[model samples]
Target: MPSQSAVGSIETKGFPGVLAAADAMVKAGRVTLVGYIRVGSARFNVNIRGSVSEVKTAMAAGIAAVEKTEGATLESWVIIPRPHENVDTILPIHYTPESEIYRQRVEGGGAPLQSLPGNS
Candidate 1:
């Protein structure tokens, strides 16, 4: 399988903060809002995929949004450019049906990896 593109993630303390971060990320850059993982302890991680620069832009926006939200704590954030295909399959960072449109818009060329079916 082909390797996946860059991936960015922002972990926030609550659902609302993560929601805000997701919105900010999409609006701030040409990045796909792949999915969010809900870790235990009420934390959620918003993930996006794009070019390295775009991923960085999106992550910055996400972090800012998380910081600005009341009662929301930014636990962590990361950007992995050109991640291994194994990581794509093994981690919860792949695109979903819901994010296909955004992926298309951001990628703007070849198709992305087959989206994991169902809601993320």
Candidate 2:
């Protein structure tokens, strides 16, 4: 565990779901996060840093807790591992065709401007 703090983000759904997930971490140990979660939410980004084990534990617990909530969904890219270190990104970063809608909404990477929702 490095002596410095770490950062992580989880793009999830439901404000209550985010809150519930956060609460679980508090139960596990001391940590911190940001943003508000709610239903049909576009995203949920949280930053938590501590001992490596503690941070990993909190992250797993938080995501698990979020998943337990009804209507709470996690994008495949939701887990941003060691974002500070590009090499630490373990999850596949690509979005499948089935997930294009949600992926575009969250990433805003780019697509035909006219095809985007509300673009018309």
Candidate 3:
């Protein structure tokens, strides 16, 4: 079935900031870390999926974390509520097998779970 969840993305100037943002996002709210995009020039995007409210909360936390990282800058961000299915197939925002657990937890009405060490 097509997803009804919202998808959010936070672009950062460096990998470390994106990593921190992803960690903060899942910890701060019920969201799934779907994947990321390398936009070249050392820019990267950390993407997440959840309900609109959850995504918004996670995005805020992500931006804050990115801001706190040394030499890392927040480039941009977006949240698409109920994105079209075609977008999932056409874009790199879809969740992978490793991130499926987070999506399941969030959809099951549980708090977001943290990634285990060495899993990413």
Candidate 4:
């Protein structure tokens, strides 16, 4: 799975549905979480790794499923590779931000706010 190692990373936004999708992948042995999935109200990101086909398939299906759930919005996604796939490096920095705007908006335990009409 070397060539497939870093086909790239996938991210999805949603809540329990997204969570359930991740759960299904794990249960089905399709992919594994390489790290923590950023949890928030406005958005969330889950990192997954596995065979290329399964990775992409699960991501698409999962995101779609989550988006269909109540209180969820599909954001952006990309197939960017993981850092240092073959270089064998050590993590020297934290990638997640605790003070990010998304986190702030999602704080206080209520659902995150959606953009106002005409705000784009």
Candidate 5:
């Protein structure tokens, strides 16, 4: 990850909203989807990281997605332009091994991973 990348998050009232947000976010910008968090009581959060401008763009798309979801609501969101390193160390926002594949592909000039066809 670049030292200057930004981190952003969208909190939604339901899993459907968060899922919508995550999909729109990555498609809207060259951002990496870190992961989702279950914040209890049916609430969830979608976290992402990318350039400051890209993060801002992704946040907009994500918020729109949440609003469009049938039974979901956007609760809150945030974008940290240059969060301190310690924040990455302690927060679940940091990329995991599973997500690293996408990051690596993006950095290596390859497209991010996509779903494979299901077996019959």
Candidate 6:
């Protein structure tokens, strides 16, 4: 069966903008930062995947971040709810094993990063 997760992409005109979007996206929702795509001409895309609601939340936060970044233009964006299996297989939206850990942590409501005791 096709995955129940949604996929989203936010495009920005510059790297700094895209990076800001990515950081905000992941922080604002329980979504995974799937990957970044360089679309030539200084444009970049930040991909994310998660539940429909989560994807929507992340997209909103990401777009806002891009808007605030200097010299970063919001190019375009899309969010596909329950994308086809073929799309997941062909696109870079699927989560890797490494990213799965993050997904699980978020889903389980675990902290994004664990703090080591007495590290400071």
Q: Which one wins on TM-score?
A: 5
Q: Which 10 consecutive residues of model 2 have the lowest summed lDDT?
A: 87-96
Q: What is the C-alpha lDDT profile of model 4 across 1-120, one tens digit per residue?
A: 245543223345555655755555444435544544565654566555555665676566656666666766656554434435433234311223432332233223332445422344
The true-structure Cα RMSD of candidate 1 reads 5.3
Error of 1 at 93 (Å): 0.9
Q: Which scores higher on lDDT, 2 or 6?
A: 6
Residues 6-58 of candidate 1: C-alpha lDDT, one tens digit per residue: 89989889998999999999999988888888897989988888888888988
| lDDT on C-alpha atoms for all candidate structures | 0.84, 0.52, 0.86, 0.48, 0.87, 0.87
Instruction: For candidate 6, write residues 35-86 as lDDT tens digits.
Output: 8989889999889988999999999999999999999999999999999888
Misplaced by over 4 Å in model 3 are: 1-3, 109-120
lDDT of 5 by residue, 25-115 (tens): 9899888899998998999998998889989999999999999999998999999998888998899989888777666654566443454
Could you tell me the C-alpha RMSD of candidate 5 in Å? 2.6
Q: 95-118, model 2: which lDDT tens digit per residue? A: 245445533433346466577666
TM-score of each: 0.83, 0.51, 0.85, 0.51, 0.88, 0.87
Sorted by TM-score (best first), the order is 5, 6, 3, 1, 4, 2
What is the TM-score (0 to 1) of candidate 1?
A: 0.83
Against the correct fold, how does model 5 do in TM-score? 0.88
Query: What's the CA error at residue 35 for candidate 6, in Å?
Result: 0.7
Local error of candidate 6 at 114, Å? 1.8
